[model samples]
Target: MDSPSSSTGPQPIVNSRPGGRRRSILSDFLSDSLPQPSSFLSTSPGIAREILTQDIAECSSSDDDDEQAAASDAESASGPADAKLAFHPNGIVWGAGCSLVPTHSRDRPVPNPHEVEESLHAELSLLRDNAILPPKHRRPRTTNAFARLYRRNFSTKVRDHEGPIVPDVAVETTPMLREIPPTPGPEEIERRFEFAVAHHEIRTTWQREAKTLIQYSTPLIATFLMHYSVTIGSVLTVGRLGLVELAAVNLATMTASITCYVPVQGLATCLDTLCAQAYGSGHKHLVGLQAQRMTWLLWILMVPIALLWWFSEPILAALVPSKETASLAATFLRVLIAGMPGVAMLESGKRFVQSQGLFKATTYALMMGAPLSFLQNWLFVFKFGWGFVGAAAAMAITQNLLPLLLVLYVWLVDGSRCWNGFSRKALRNWGPMIKLALPGMIMIEAQFSVLEVLTLCAGQFGTSQLAAQSILVTVTSTSFNIPFPLAIATSTRVANLIGADLSQAAKVTAKVSIIAACMVGCFNLLLFTTFRDLLPRIFTDDVEVIRIASQALLVCGVMQVFDAIAAVAHGLLRGIGQQAIGSYANLFSYYLVALPISLSTAFALGWRLTGLWAGITVGLLCVSVIELAYLHQTDWEVAAAQAADRLRSEDVAEVKLRRHSHSSYHMEV
Candidate 1:
């Protein structure tokens, strides 16, 4: 029994090449078992090939008169001059369909309907004869079944006219067709569509998704590295001042991240959903509204956070063994209080632009910020002779400047459509945002607070051990920036494939992602192990600090493999919408399994800084194992079905929203 294509299928796009193609060692028989979503051709690459080949076949025919007659009949019966027909296996034809690609320009025209249909039928028949398409997908030999299947998918108008296809009311009323962009002639669009389609068709699953993952991950990795440079600059500069200063800076940054920065970022992540939904649903102004609301909420929460930072000297003095390090750390936190609002706004602003698909804006802004941050750190700490206070001042100024640069980009270049000046609407819609924000904040803060615990544990040994802990943390963080972002990209692609009901394709993506993670982990392991002694010198001149840090690097180096695989596993969990399970796994592994062992090994057994990292490595290994097992056991078809169900619910809500908006407009008029 053949069914019509799902309404929640992927939207059309002209040319969206993910990256360069590469082949894998996987056998053709194995690769052929994995099937892509029906909508992928329209949205990905293959549709262009179908269009071009069909067009060429019809135009280059031996019978010129028959071709001319067919063309004339199609043109007259096509209804709209911009009508483009795409063929689906179920016999449905899509005409003048809107694209999902976020473009400011007009939509591109495609080949005529009759020509496309004929070409597709010829190709499918050839495939069937050659036994390329799996036996299950081959057309029935009986005419009765063929006619019945065709009747089920096609409109009555298509059967009656037997010329150009026309969509029914249900197809015409789809959200995609509601707001049609202007149309451009065929000459203006790229003719490389067929090339893109062929490239998509020939590649193995591993080869295809690996390239796509790289394409998504490369820029993200760069962005994370630059963003991390802000903290790196402060650590490197302060490490040179003294052992006490190095320990204080790391302690201060870790405390600040746990108590403040992590929460802000985590809370702001709600905008990733809110702003994206608003923009995609045509409620553009809501993007700014959501951002504004988040910013205001963060500012309100920061009131208590500011007070805590301001009077933190007494608290820190009691907590740490060294009074000098505690006082210095307190001073650093106090100076950082001014930068809280900047951090809040930057987090929100990133989501706002990202929601609109303006990803490069943040990258461009950070390109300027990273170098300036390093320069400011050098000038203030060394040139101006402000010491630790100068380092704090530079960090504060840089944080504030990042948001300003992002705003300037939005104002001058693009993404301004979402912003319609400040409005009071941001103040009222507080409940929904807060509910989403708190859970995310708790989860993030829980993960980040582990660093603070590890630092505190290391401090119990002595000042040199504490300083070594700082370097170890920095190296771990910098290494993490690579795999974490790659994981995020993997999650996005996998989730998309799942949503499209391409279970086999999603599985392929998952396998490719884990392999990529393994490769990254090995590279980090090599770098750390090979340069353990030399790497610590880049930060400080102190002999004891360098010696301790170099020793700890051996443990840290081994942790990288588990760390990368664990991160990618977490991403896969998110992609499958099984984040709760991953969260539970993290809590169990880190708290129940890692913390007690670290305290026992570091203090009781006297393994020192190396023992502290060993515990974390154990936790990461457990997380990777547990999550990978869950993924391997997951029923991918069920996951895809759940994703489709979710998409259908969202579509229903969107339709209602449009209807409500239409009614409101009518009432106003």
Candidate 2:
């Protein structure tokens, strides 16, 4: 957060002086201890002054040619800063003179890499020992290759320019100077330098980042799979009740998911950012408050959705060719209305715990709830002879049951501190939350509604094809669960890298993620191809349903890679703050390309279920291709700059709010 000073001294080497000034130990230790100031600091305040000063003092630009060269250099440097502030966690301004460090270039002498490593280690120890930043806010440690390279590049720039850490300041008696740490001896510095450069290759960064991604995503994958199982359980149990029943359940769930479940999940996503910021900023109760607000908002929103469900039979009848299927779907939706509040709370509560880094809360709840849902489905549908109605009832009960388990886990185990019990506060200040919720809901809806549209289109082909559509939806959704969570993890990682001003590292991570996604896609592709005959049997036993699904499974198999790529690309777009591009691309590709191709081929050309999936497959391909192109063309450096600006703006807003009053400012999530 350091601002450049106009009257700063010429760059001075850590242990040397051009005017025979006495070299100070404290300056040298600080030079070695603080991580290198970012090369992207040319946009900071007073940088123009610094550049003009250097041009006048050093270039002696009496000639227009020399003046033009300096002007060009200044032009190149003038822009919004892309780098984050290099302020120390304990409030030390170690990078006070960062703007004065000549921008990195090929001409700069490479500093001893060992010295760089040791210097970074010292600063990392400082950050760790102080514990000023919570776990969520901690940047990557010095062990990361990119982090080391940043330190190395910083050392080279400061050494080449001889810029002081703080311009024109007394090393001794400086404000907030701590006891000087011991400096390395000549032998130690030389030895470490040799060691650093000798081992400077960052070959391990890929492996290290990959390992980190896998480890972080593993729990999420499990959690998402179990969550999906709740619905899959219903599909499996309901599919056993005969072809009509299976088709009814499929139609019902599709209606519920697109109209209710997906939107609720999407709106709840706002808390991912809101609650995390609250927890990281030490407002733990704000996390719960935010969740409560979202829950209430969703419940209020649900009033209309519930009403729609209650009267949806006519709507479904108009859209779907099978009036019987439409009526059954309406019945299922009406039954599901009883669980709307529970679904809202569960989605909100998941974010509540996830933001606190306690992912296992939802996992544990689903661990018990998933099987119980399955058992309930069995009892109601077969043992209890309730048929399709029984399956709907079981799913509704399970939906309600999940939030209770989540609440119990919070109260009994960890994450209880965030909750302060019910208050009218939850009912107040719905604007900011709504603003974030609407866009997220729209984005998620855009992604999911296309699939439901395809289902509606499939309903024209007869119940067998509709049942096959259900089987296809179930298989693909299950497959999608894996990469979707992985994509979330990727988004978090890439965002962290961008925020740290490590664009090169962020690019590397994006590559790794895309590669991982491709691998996952291929794995899914192999499974679908290999098990196409057997996969449908898990859901139903009707010969025609399985046959239609099997033929479509080939199309679904081809779609996997594209679907996987699209999922990861969406995540990558989110990480770089370019999700608006993705939102547009999804709407364009699905509605224009996928829908047209699907309708024309299915109805116009009489291609049946295969044509439906064929259209979706092409849409997936279009989406993936567009997303990847955008990601490829994006200037990561600018993205990082914008991210820093956003973070700074948020901090400024928070500070202004805190300055006015602690309690009077309406809390906006």
Highest TM-score against the true fold, candidate: 1
Q: Candidate 2 versus the native: TM-score?
A: 0.70
**Could you tell me which 10 consecutive residues in candidate 2 have the lowest summed lDDT?**
91-100
- TM-score of predicted model 1? 0.72
In lDDT terms, how accurate is model 1?
A: 0.65
Q: CA lDDT of 601 in candidate 1?
A: 86
Query: TM-score, each model?
Result: 0.72, 0.70
| Stretches of model 1 off by over 4 angstroms after superposition | 1-203
Q: Candidate 2 at 267: error in angstroms? A: 2.3
Alpha-carbon shift of residue 212 in model 2 (angstroms): 1.5
User: lDDT score of model 2?
Assistant: 0.63
lDDT of 2 by residue, 508-537 (tens): 567778889899999999999999989999
